[model samples]
Target: MGSVLKLYIQVAFAVKIVSCSITMVDNTTSKSPIDLSTAFLLRVDQSGQGDYKRIQEAIDAVPSNNSELFFIWIKPGIYREKVVVPVDKPFITLSGTEASDTVITWNDSGDIFESPTLTILATDFIARYLTIQNTHGNTGKAVALRVSGDKAAFYGCRITSYQDTLLDDAGRHYYSNCYIEGAVDFIFGNAASLYERCHLHSMAEESGAMMAQKRESPLENTAFIFLGGKITGVGSTFLGRAWGAYSRVVFALTYMSGVVKPEGWNDWGDSSKQRSVYYGEYKCSGPGANRSKRVTWSRSLTKDEAAPFLTKGMIGGRGWLRPSPTHFKKYQTS
Candidate 1:
């Protein structure tokens, strides 16, 4: 009888696993972007099994203004701490064993300028195969990650929070195959950024807000391009809202879930922005692609109009960015 019960339990567990896998692959549930067990120069493990027990310790050890690639490998575990990559520590790479297991988290929510859990101010920096989370659930303006450095990239990482999950504050940046979760203005910034082959998951918030880009004017070299991604959430979602007069955001060849609202873009209660913001789309699909209901201010770009944004050159990355080594096939990573 015991053997029979054990067999039944095993079968039920296997069925549960199968159901979860199907849901994740169908994009109904958020999945780890990818698994990359890459080598690195430094290591962090809380079990005292690596070069250091703290991520910040490993980073603080890196030479200032270092020209070479200083890789720091963090093993599987939850690291509850705020981490900052200072301006002098250039060419730093913070990697993990895998995205689903390695976590760097903190619980703090305050003003946008002071609440980031992870701040990257160093140039030529890359973070991959891990998670950065602000654990202050439903708290005000908690930032999981913020990057204000030039030539930065994120690959196969997860930035999780409720509001303001990622502050792509300012830089020439790239995000490939990462999982980002938030409810309001989660992917907001004033940067030249390209998000390729990534996954955006929204929390179970009633008010759906995503992508609040701040670009003051047309000549400002900052814009956001999201390409070949999936947008999934529990509640209604807006593609973006103009945080500045000329906020620029484009979605190209992405799949959006039904949770996205038909209106597409918001003006933050200002009617004047409707005439100035540059919100455009090209070849986006799924339930959210109902362009007829989109705001008249939003645009459906022509093939020629989208050609510039479809390339990495849109962020002036050809001179510095390199291969992503993971999900993206054609474009460079960082």
Candidate 2:
């Protein structure tokens, strides 16, 4: 409920997930002979020095049904590709040079299903210190990152797009110290995802919605929990919109800039969605957090209800969210 508790909850969550000594450094993979006894490290560089030139090449080289950790070091450069870690691949890591330096990008619209710059559909996948962008401009619903795998974690990463920046389609996900920017429903889908100390930026022309959660059933284990983050950007934006009957999105202990619309949640054109969608915020600050104008259907979560959002347990990722140490210089969005 409080910022201090949120910090403690996330730290405790990471403690349960992290274990090991072997780490990887890359411009893409560590090429040295891996001591599986220690760690599997592969280096990647577009200049053809690392294990693979393209990120997908390194990914394709990985053996399937892997139980051990496989780390890829991505060199500092702009990689133009749509990368996917299939459903059978697990325990994979794509470590980058830096969030700003190492970039994997593509341009695709959302006409067909699964149109994204990066789609991770494997369990126990981890990506750190990189920027995943969809350069398709604001023409349509372009997605930058789509995570459909279970128990995936993203640390110190930047996901940028115009319409749909991140589609947390399914699974339990953790995003820590990350930057996510888009215009409408940028952070969407039905994943049980936790965003800790991240930045949500809105690049809107007029009316923009930050998230579009699509949880249709009451029994579905899905929600978007944004804890201890900041919302800042241009134009008018709502905190989220309901994409399904039981859509859910929560912002706890966050700072909302003036660009955020006071209504906070939109039901789109469907007035019925307002009755079923669960949208809430607790103890948020900034001019955009003006509760007087917020919709009556939305709520100010009680501390008990808000407490769960701060913990990794809310996303059912308690045992596998171990985020490795990061050297990312925190970007300021103030």
Candidate 3:
């Protein structure tokens, strides 16, 4: 009898320990307002004992509303798959082993229907040192990365597609130290985006590349501002065409290649857009950057007028900006 009682006590103790551990884990993961710095690091290769080997699996494991920072450390490899970061998943950071070592790629075109390599609709997301690509070149509106998230940032990354490669669909996003390559409306969308210190490469094309389509609420004040960037194309390429009547874009201090046309804007088969579109350039240089006979509708913005659009407060707003290092570290391992 004494032995039996001792065995029962042991079983009860084990169950208690397991229950307590599960509760702790649940508390840690379910908390709202997650801190990204503390999130677990996921490695695609066998480098770490993460929850999963594939990027999509790791993303799936994260709770839809996890309020903790989650980091996916991707290994060096080319992952060809359609990845989507849905709206409910926030505070996710995807880091690569190295910019050149890790590549996430897929092939899909708008003509193909309902195919996108990566569709991002979550807020407060960051991707660094990786390449997101769509292999469908000249296939028609193939998107490499579609970002519709607020306060989303991509650094030291490469985004490649053909027609609509880098789709800044919605929100105030930032792309720095990155490379975006495409053909037609390559970098097009309705987002208030800031591309800084990046390269915009236009493939060989007859009509050239169209940069943006700002179709948003008139009061939303959406703008695409390129700072300290370069625009290069093979054939005759117009800087952009007006996709919506109130489409707004400003190219400041950019290096334009000779392939760009002087007019700097396309009609997109809509003459009414000519009246409502606002395309402007400031301090642009290069054979293609010539604005000598630019459309009368487009004007060059003064430095002062461009200041608000460049700042983080205006682009990202208040709540979307990631926490500072001090605050971020405190939240991690809490």
Candidate number achieving the greatest TM-score relative to the actual structure: 2
Which one wins by lDDT: 2 or 3? 2
Give a tens-digit lDDT track for model 1, residues 1-334. 6743543343224222221111002222323332222112455779996668999998887756554455576778999999999999987778775788889999889977578889999888888788999989885889999999999988889999998999999989999899999998999999999999999998845667789999998899899899899999897879999999999999999999888889999999999999999999999999988898999999999999988889999777787675422211111112
Give me the displacement of residue 122 in model 3, in angstroms. 1.3
- Superior by TM-score: candidate 1 or candidate 3: 1
Lowest lDDT sum, 10 consecutive residues, model 3, at: 14-23
* Model 3, span 1-334: residue lDDT tens: 6743543343224222221111123335445564432444333554444446778877776677766666666767888788888889887877774667778888777642255687788888888788898898775778888888888988889888777887788888988889988887888888888888889888856777558676645676687878888987677778888877788888888899887887878868888888888787888888877888788888877888766656655585455656312111212233
What ordering of candidates by TM-score runs from best to worst? Answer: 2, 1, 3
Q: Name the regions of candidate 3 deviating beyond 4 angstroms.
A: 1-33, 46-50, 111-113, 317-319, 323-334
Residue 150 shift from truth in candidate 3, angstroms: 2.0
**TM-score per model over all chains:** 0.84, 0.86, 0.83
Steric clash pairs (candidate 3)? 34-67, 34-68, 35-69, 36-69, 39-69, 208-237
User: What ranges in model 1 sit over 4 Å off?
Assistant: 1-40, 323-334
Instruction: Evaluate residue 264 in candidate 3 and report its C-alpha lDDT on the 0 to 100 scale.
Output: 76
Deviation in angstroms for 255 in model 3?
1.1
